[model samples]
Target chain A: MKQLTIQSSSHAYDVIIGAGLRKKLSQKLGKSYKKILIVTDSKVSSLYLEDVKAGLPDHENLSHVIVPAGEASKSMEQYSRLLDKCIEEQLDRSSLIVGLGGGMVGDLAGFVASTYLRGVDFLQMPTTILAHDSSVGGKVAINHEQGKNLIGSFYSPVQVIYDTDTLRTLPDSEVRSGYGEVVKHALLSDMDWVKEVLSEDFSELSYSQLGDHLLAGIKVKASIVEEDEKEHGVRRHLNLGHTLAHALESDLGYGEITHGEAVAIGIFFAMKVSEKVLESTLPVDAYSAWLKTNEYPVEKLSNLNPERLVNRMKWDKKTIEDRIHFVLLKGVGSPAVVPIPEDDLVNHLKEFIEEVIQIDERD
Target chain B: MKQLTIQSSSHAYDVIIGAGLRKKLSQKLGKSYKKILIVTDSKVSSLYLEDVKAGLPDHENLSHVIVPAGEASKSMEQYSRLLDKCIEEQLDRSSLIVGLGGGMVGDLAGFVASTYLRGVDFLQMPTTILAHDSSVGGKVAINHEQGKNLIGSFYSPVQVIYDTDTLRTLPDSEVRSGYGEVVKHALLSDMDWVKEVLSEDFSELSYSQLGDHLLAGIKVKASIVEEDEKEHGVRRHLNLGHTLAHALESDLGYGEITHGEAVAIGIFFAMKVSEKVLESTLPVDAYSAWLKTNEYPVEKLSNLNPERLVNRMKWDKKTIEDRIHFVLLKGVGSPAVVPIPEDDLVNHLKEFIEEVIQIDERD
Candidate 1:
């Protein structure tokens, strides 16, 4: 088992990762909680709910809430329903909520735990590679109708237990989607790590190799989260490509594109933007080629309107006054938040969209 | 102005009390906020909204949302409507929310601020004396169908500015309601303070006298909240009369009885419970007489079912594993959490009910 502790002014918790580590939950929890509420999704529950329950300590009473599986589950309607279940089950401050699935379950469960009775103890049992990023930094949120992750808070978990056994059940597409965040983490952390991740064989990578990459991603997130728990400063670096990524997801309609896919496109655009604004040697075309090899939707920008996408970006939570800010990469491992003038941003986006469409035609 | 600082692990903020302090808000907050939302009830807005708006700095953009007055405004329906207004107003992380009314308004506004975009900077411009207690400790909540404050969290405000000028517009009933929380604070803080308050004339007390008492109440709350921010330990003492107070309000159907009136009855019963359980000298009858003089509903116990009330108390957020806990006074300024045997609680409550009914019959 690989274990690390994240310490902040508000809270401190351990992150444990290994194969079949979910079984150690009760032992790790020390049977301290009076009751445990296992929050999972339909798909995840059918696969591992009973096994997760059986792994819990006999001393602690357990209840389970199964939400719908997918991004759509992270809605206010679902959040309220989950809170209703929390009340129905009589879960109190002494109780524990175990998020027993991927990023959606983690975000939803963490948010519910944060607000229920003014917050309670929550444990994260991440079941996907994507959750390695979500589970670590304690950024739990439900999507607003107007924008993605527009309603959320910084609430740390009591512990995060990542079991590699759960990832084996994920489909190839889901795995690829998760890999996109891993790439973001790698690019933000170090150029060597980014190069290592790019060169790895996605389909045939060994379990240990995947675990190593996920751990590195978590470490990068943890360090940044530790420094700026509230996202007031250095933490914006983690947004590397999320500004346009959020716009893409909101404009195209959520669930039409996977978060990681949108992020992949955003990262490519950010690199191009970096080349224009910072004169950085990021090799945007080579990165696009790598994304294409991974079956990412790099060519989708051909059908999108630059103006519309820019308008959507204006409504992002990160916007300052009337100015829109983008977290662009100066180079691999070097990210900065720069306010692009509206006209400059539109022209650059139009040029970038045309270039992406030409690449699509050439392919 | 009398100012006291509430220091908690999560946050520390100032509680400022004075007449006409609301007008000083612009000077105090500076012009840093992107926008401000003034959340008040219709009754308060009709009387003070424009003046409150005039008090804001010209550089700071401000908006207002007036909710319905009275306890019904604390309902989940109103809470959702308030959230909708927050969304409509485009409140971002840089925004400020000024809760500009009584306890209901403070609770509702604080809750909305706590959750809106995962929390923003919120100030408490409490218009009622009742808010002397609610506005300080950051215990903001909306009511659930099952119970009061069932859906809530401990989110501290940036500052609490209690302008006694607004209290002049409140009716005698509102003043009495505000006084109950003041009494709770006195009972929890100092014995001499309690005796002094009990001997004071309710209707004849001057504005400055009320402000002095309110300041004392705020100090008591600040000290306790400072010691235990999250209510994990000594904070339960702050819930002194709240458990039964919640049950009384829930049983009597909310708007039919005010929060402080319910708390008044709860305090009287807790004293009786203390006399029975701890063999403490509390002079419950004298206190009951004082409550009666203040026009508090001391005789409402005549209509309530002890079994149902106990059942409701069982569902209180403070309960642990089916055990109902009550914060009972050992004497003035002394409180402790005690688990009453089910039969004993019901029997004592029945006895208490009989005594209250006899008093009602005599009247």
Candidate 2:
């Protein structure tokens, strides 16, 4: 088991990564909380709710609330229901809420916990690699109908327990989706980590190998978060590929494409934009080849309209005075925000989309 | 203008109290925000929304969202609508939300501002005297059907601008309601202030006189909030009469009774309970007389069941492990948390109800 401590301004918590640690949660949770509500998604509950229950303290007051699986669960409707469930179960300020699933469950549960009775103690048990980045750094939110994660807050959880055993159940698509964030973290952190990741076969990552990569990503995130918990300065670097990523998700209609899949394509566009605007020295083609080798569907970008994508990007929280602020790389591990004029951004996006289509036709 | 700064752990902001300050808000908010959403209730909008809009910069992005007046507006339904309006209006990270009304408007808008886009800057323009207390302490929340302020967080506004001119339009009942918090603040802080308050005719107080009292109340609140922002210790003392006040409000049903009037009765019972439990040498009869003179309806408690009221108190955030924790006073200005046995509390409440009836009949 490897444990990392994240010291944020509002909270300090541990991100515990290990195999089979989910079963020992009750002992880890201690005896302070009188009421425990385990919130999981339908998919995760079907696979691991009983095991999670088995791990909890043998107290009759312990209960569970399940939200439907997928991105839809991260809505205002679900948030309200979860709050009602907390009140119905008599969960108090001292009661604990354990988020037992992937990113959706963690985001929903963390948000509910943050707003429930003002705020309450909550634990995150991330079941997917995509959550390795999300489950840390205390950014929890539900999506609005207008956009993804449009309504949310920065609320840190009490602890994050990533049980590697849960990863065994995830589909290959989900695994690839999780790697999108892993690749972003690598880009923002070190070229050596990026090289190490490229050297490995993405399809056959061992549990130990995934754990090591996740911990490295979390360390990069934790350090950045500790410096700027509210995203006043350096925290914007974390949104490296998210500007285009969110636009794609919104334009494509959320849940139609996986978050990491959109992010993988977003990273590609961010690199191209970086080369055009910042004169970045990044090996964009090499990274593009690596993404294709990992089976990330970069070819899907050809189907999206540049104008609609740019329009969607206009609504991003990072946009200031209608100028789209893209997190561009100067070199490996060096990310900076440069405002792209709308006309220029639109032209670049159109060119990139055409190039992606041409490359796909050649292949 | 009387200004006091609140230094909470999460945020530090000033409480600016004066007449006609709402008209100067645009100049105050300055160029920092590109979008401004002025949130007010219908009553406040009818009276002051135009003045508020006129004060703001000549920016087309400024908008207003009005909720219905009163406690019913402090619900999950309204909260969801407010969020939707925020997203629809495109209020971003650097935008502003000005809460313009009574306690309900402040609570609702403050909560939306706290959660919108994770969190955004908000200004509180309090229209009621009760809001002098609510608007200062950074405690923003909407109500759950189960309890008053059952779901909320400690999110302080950037500034609290209490325009005393707006108080002229408030009904007698509203003024009385605002005094409940003032009396509680007086009790929690200074005996001299309490004596001075009791000596005044609440019905005929001038604007300047009310401002003096409100400023004193805010100072007491600001000092306590600075010491314990999250209610870990001394901050709970602020909830002195709130325990029974919330119970009575819940039992009578919110909107049926004014919060301050209920708090006035709650204060009477709290003192009686304090004397019975702690042998507190409080001038209970004198305080009871002052409440009657101030037009507080103490007779309302005669209609409530002791057991029902106690049950509602069980749901209070202050209640711990089933033990009833009441903020009782050893004497004036010396409040302390005292856990009473259930049987003893019920018996005291029944007897106190009888005493209030006897006193009313004598009057």
Candidate 3:
């Protein structure tokens, strides 16, 4: 197992990654926690809940709560229910909340743990490929009807245990969704890394190879998060494609598109806006083609109304003074945030949408 | 104006205490905030919202969201509604959330500010004397149906503006409720403070004299909180009268008694338990008499069943391993958290309840 220590102003914790690490849970968790609540989803609970519980200390009071397995579970209602569940289980200040599923589970559980009894000991045990990115940063939140992750806080977990063996069960679609973040991380890095990610066939990779990609994305995330845990300045760089991603998620309804799939689609527009607005022009064709080849469905952009999408972006949490902004790439490995007036962004977005349709028609 | 700078792990801010301090809001907040959402209660809105708004910069896009003016307003349902309000107002990351009311408004608005857009700039403008304690220490939260402040976090505000002028318009009951904390602070300090608090007449204090009392409580709270913001060790001492305070509030229903009033009664029993358990015995009769003379309904304790209140204490957020704990004092200024097993607590509580009835009948 490889352990990467994450440092924050509040506390420092480890992200332990390896194959079949679920069996090592007790060794990491120790005997300090007076109570432990394992929060998993309906699907992961049926599959791995018992197995995960088997690895916990027998003497400790262990319990589990499960929500349905989807983004819809990341709601204010679900958050309230989980809090009631924690209270029902009598999880106290010394208790531990084990987030034992994927991104949705981790986000929901992390948020509940963050607020229950003010805060509690939280351990993230991600059961999906997407969580490799989501679990590392301490951005725990639930969705508001108005926007994705509109209600939340920056609460670091006590530890993150990413057992690679769990990834073996993810569907191909889930795997591709997970790679949307991986590719975004690559784009944020140098051209060589982006080329490497584009050339790679994610489905065929072994657990070790997959771990390498996950580690790369995590390293990028951890490095950025360490610099600014609360997203003061440098942290905005990590939100490379999430502006449009959140807008799409809010407009389409949360469950309609996976977060990373929306992010993949967002990256295409971010590149176009980057080229048009910034002096540094990206080869938009190359990036779009990479997404298309990877089964990311970049054609989804054709279905959007530019003004509506840009209007939706107005409510984005990252905005300032109600002005819309985009994290545009100055070049590969160099991203800068530029505030575009709503009218200007709508115009640029219209051009981008036409280009997406033309590219779809030509192909 | 007395500007006490509160130092915390994240950021240090000022708690400006004086008469008519609401007029000083913009001078402290300055022109940086692009947008501001003032969250107030209906009562406070009628009294001070327009007046408070007058102090703010007119150039900024200022808006207000009003919650119902009571403890019932401190619910998950209200929290969800406020978040929607923020989204509707389009309060972004750089915007500010101005909490304008008593303890309920401060707590609910503070929680929303802490979680909205992950977090936003929060300014506390307290309208009640109880908020002199609540607004200062960074303990922001909303209530779960299971318990009071069962869901919360330690999020400090940018600044706290406590206007003594606002206190002039408060009902006599609200002023007494506010003193619940002021007197508790004295009990947790020393004999001199306790004596001073007992001798003081609340209804006649000049704004300056009241500010002096609020400053004393804020100093004690600020010192303790700076030492332990998340209530790890020393900070638990600050919860001296709160164990029974929470239980009574939960049992009687939230709106039945004001928070400080319940705290005043809780202080009476806490002293009894402290004398029974600790080496240093308190003059329980003196404390009970002071509470009775001060209009605190200490007799309410007689109505409660011992086992039920003891059971309620088990659900307290301060608990560990489902064990009952109390911030019992050895004497004034010396408090310790003791883990009392259920049966022992039930017996002790039974004795205290009987004593309360006897005192009530005799008087």
In terms of lDDT, which candidate is strongest? 2
Write candidate 2's Cα lDDT for B1-363 as tens digits: 888877877767778888788888865653467889999999999999998898887569899999999899999999999998988887888889999998999999999998888889989999999898889888899988777887777798998888899999988888889989898999987788988887767767888989999999988988898888888999989888888898888888877789988887888888988887889998776788788787788778778899988887887853455678889999999999988877788898899899888888787
Per TM-score, what order, best first? Answer: 2, 1, 3
Task: Check candidate 3 and list the clashing pairs.
Answer: none
- Model 3, B1-363: lDDT tens digits are 888999977899988888777876787773478788999998999989888888887645899999998888989988988988888878878789999999899999999998987888899999999999899888899987777888898899998888889999988668778888998788777788778777767656667768888999999899899988887789888777788888898888777778888888777777887777776677566777766766777667767887888777766745654467688888888888887778888898888888788987886
Give the CA lDDT, 0 to 100, for residue A77 in model 1.
87
- Listed per model, the TM-scores of chain A against the true chain A are 0.96, 0.97, 0.95
Candidate closer to the true structure by TM-score (higher is better), 1 or 3:
1
Per TM-score, the best of the predicted structures is 2
- Candidate 2 residue-wise lDDT, A108-148, digit = tens: 99999988888999899999989998898888999887777
Mind giving the per-residue lDDT tens digits that candidate 1 earns over A99-209? Answer: 999999999999889888878888999998888988988788887666667666678898988888889988766777788789898888777887787776567867898
Question: Mind sharing the TM-score for model 3?
Answer: 0.93
- The predicted structure with the larger DockQ, 2 or 3, is 3
Candidate 3 Cα errors over 4 Å, as ranges: A250-256, A273-289, A320-323, A341-344, A361-363, B281-286, B320-323, B341-343
For candidate 1, write residues B1-363 as lDDT tens digits.
Answer: 787877856667888888887777787673478788899988988888888788777544688888888877877678677777777778788889889998889999998888777788888888887888888877888876666677777889998888888888888777878888888888887778888777766778788888899889988888888888878788889877787888888888877778787787788888889988888877576677787677777666777898988888877744565556788988888899988877788888899889877876687
**Which wins on lDDT, candidate 1 or candidate 2?**
2
The per-prediction CA RMSD against the true structure, in angstroms, equals: 2.2, 1.5, 2.6
